[model samples]
Target chain A: MLTVKHLAKSYNGTKKSLTDVSFSVSPGEVTVIIGPSGAGKTTILRSINQLIRDDDGEILFDDVDMRQLNRRQLRDARSHIGMIFQNYNLIEPLTALENVLHGCLGTKSNLAGMFSLYRNSEKTEALQLLQKVGLGDFAYQQCRNLSGGQKQRVGIARALMQHPKIILCDEPIASLDPKSTTVVMDLLRDLATNDGISVLINLHQVDIARTYADHVIGINNGQVVFDDRTAALTDTAVTDIYRKTTSSERSLVYEG
Target chain B: MIKPENQVSLPTQLPAGPRFTIPLRFRDRRRVTMLITLLILGYVTLITLPTMIPDHFKLVEAITGFTENIKIMFLQPHLSNTSWLSLLGGLGQSILLAFLTTLIGSVLAFFLALASTRRFAPTALVLGIQSFMAVIRAIPTVLWVLIYSVVFGLGANAAVIGITFHSVAYLTKVYADSMDELSPEAIETLQAMGLKRPAIICQALIPYLKPSYLSWTFIRFEINFADAVAIGAAAGAGGIGYQLFMSSSFYFDFHEVGVMVYLILAFAVVLEIISYRLRSSNTAQH
Candidate 1:
């Protein structure tokens, strides 16, 4: 479970990138945030982890405020939170399994992690996740050599390695192919449903959000305009968030 | 087909205009400026020559005598030859100083460069510090070494500090520029993945910078090595430059000076080749 209360962020003497927006997700729930470009969707996710400092707000993760935590405390608090990206930000020089192993690094002793003192259990778990992601044979392969789809899958497995209570995906499938897009979306959905991980994903694809999310939150210009159960939204209801622009380009963002 | 009428006749065509002709008729301002500058230089030299020096007749005679004596001396190689070991021995301290200082300066400069980079800087204050490093670089290494030779009590230690300080400035600029070239997308991706700042630099930025960094270091090393001689001589300390200085001051001990110059040039060339090879091998391996 996660709660963001009246969150606001202004980056470096500039206009607020995020306004007093609020949203919450229940345990094992897939909460999707859909917005046009520059809607502060990514900022919201980053703020929850305190990667981006919010000027005003409280992010309660299991009822503990993350914004108030100090450096070491924040680092420790981060183990329960896993984040992925569109770019599949694995250390390129590292192998697939070695990168997945990086997820456990926060909880493992820093000394042990630095010298690569991985436990047999952690290695087994990493290999198992790779298998679950259909990447068992590519464990030894360097991340740089992987295709976009495979890399995102490895990104998921790497996130899953944390055994996180909450997972944040900032357009994890935006750069992927249609087939790979569905596979990744389905995996996120399955994780939220089966693994009981609270997930908040930002996406441009309205159809994928509707197909996979348990709930949808629409954000526009740093504000959350709509939040509802995914099942409750009719086709017309979805249009209000995407109806401002008439160009084919605007429709492509949430065309379906 | 029997009449060969089916065979396609080559069509007459106007050739594409002037594919390889030089535009000789056109003259740009650049060419005009160059010609004017050359003419002025030639005119000034012609006017100044023969009158600039006092007693040209005696001067020419003296030069001729010096040349003949030098020629005779060179012909007898066994007479005034400086031993190879002594020449190299005098150069050792300067080379050692350059090596030590470059090692220290560059290592620190890398961190300084990282801190200075807009991408990695903790704050604006850090960026300001990187600029100050540029001021250090603007001053020549020889000048800095000369100053430090006095401030640091005039020796190879002074030479080392001076070289290190200057090398740091040069290297920081290189490092920072390379850091700037890193993809903002890559950095954002790393940060999004919850990696720490240090990890982001080590993981994403370092790999991209490795080739350029290695190349820059080798190039800088070669430069610094030559500078060692210059700074070494100037710093009131002993080096190949000091030996060269001594030989020159002693009046045309070409045999001794020649050997030292040859040795320095040879070592420098050898170092350059080794570094070039190392960089090539490193890139291939990675």
Candidate 2:
């Protein structure tokens, strides 16, 4: 389980990108954050891994504060927290299996890592993970040669290689076509439902979020407006969560 | 039917052309034409200025003499003083010098390039290394060789050290530039997965940089070979270049010089073929 409390960030110290954002993700559940562009969905996900250090926050993963950890501790903490990107982010020149094996880099010795001395066990696991994601045949193929859907699947296998407790996906399907989006979303959903891994996703497609998410967190202008079960996210609630915020409404929120 | 207020009404007889044209800001057609014309004029003036021959110079006789020398050199090239085996040995020495320098320089440059990249090192360190390298690169490789010749006393040692030093600076700049072209997202993904800097470099940077590194190092190797030949006579390094220098300047053996020139050209052609083979094979693997 993970809990983020009072997370705030500002680029220029003037305009807040995220304001008092608070949310929690449960184990074995697909939690999707939905918002329009620049609504701070990405900021929140990046902040969870401490990738973009936030101005103020308490990110408690199993009651350990992620923000308070030192360099070594943060790396150790991050080893258990997998992240996926919209771009797939696999080293294109490396083979698919190699990219998957890279998932365990946090657990390897520096010398071993430099020489890429993956053990037989680790290599087997990587190949298996690729197989699980339906990329067993393309294990030795370069990632650049993979299609978008296949690449995202490879990325998923990579995250799984970490044996992570939770996976944070930042618009993983943004660049994907409709069919690839379905395949990737189904894969993430399967990870949550069957594998019991926590899945936290930032999504722009409301319909996809509604289909896959067990819980939904709706953000508007850096503020969390809706946080509840998917069944509770009625049409009206969805509309209200996505409604444009005016200056007066912003001022009202600021006052409150 | 009423048109929407947001929609503008069009004239029944529309204008045939645009009324106001957007002018070119900095490089209009006329300005480009004028600039090119000025460059041509400058080039013509430079060439014509060099044609101010001395009043009594026998231009025809000099041309004929030059042609005669060329004919003898090309048509009757044969080693008179230097044996073929010695020339081959000299070429081999020069090649070994180049190979040694390139290997040493590329290894040193790899580490320095990592430090110079902003992703791996601190901003101050990156900037410092980059600026220092720029200073090193500003001076030509030959000058560096001569400068080291002062310290090492003008021999193969000086040539090797000097060439390697300049090669390091040159390769570092290029390697760092190639490293900079890697997508930050790829690095961030690795970092987010808890990979350390070294692991990220090995797993991410190295694979991406392999092709570029190979090509750049090979290019530097070629340059080092050429520099080795030049410094053989200049720094007393003793290679084929020294033999050519002796034959042409001291003995006035144009045929021997021609033999050396052809040997160098053949070697250069072989190097080019090897480079092409390497580049194509590397691309094919990828």
lDDT of 1 at B247: 70
Best by TM-score: 2
List, residue by residue over B1-286, the lDDT tens digit for candidate 2: 6669768877899779998788668658998899999999999999987688777789799999999889878888999998999999999999999999999999999999999998788999999999999999999888988999999998889999999999999999999999888878888998998888888888888888899899999999999999999988788888887787899999999998889999999999999999999899888876
lDDT of 1 by residue, B93-184 (tens): 65676677778877987998888887867668566876788788788988888788677887777778888888898888888888888778
- Write one digit per residue (lDDT tens) for candidate 1, span A1-256: 7899999887764666777889998999999999888878989988988878889988999888998988777877786688888888777767899888877766665465546678899999999999999899999998888999999999899889888899999899989999999888888888988999988899999888888888999887677878999987677767767656445633443322
Candidate 1 TM-score versus the reference = 0.76
Give the worst 10-residue stretch by lDDT in candidate 2 chain B.
B19-28
Note the residue pairs that clash in candidate 1.
none
Report per-candidate TM-score of chain A alone: 0.93, 0.97
Tell me how each candidate scores on DockQ against the true complex.
0.16, 0.55
Q: What is the DockQ score, from 0 to 1, of model 1?
A: 0.16
- After the best TM-score superposition of candidate 1, give how far the Cα of residue B201 lies from its true spot, in angstroms: 4.9
TM-score of each: 0.76, 0.90
The runs of at least 3 residues in candidate 2 whose Cα sits more than 4 Å from the true structure, single-residue gaps closed, are: A251-256, B1-56, B281-286
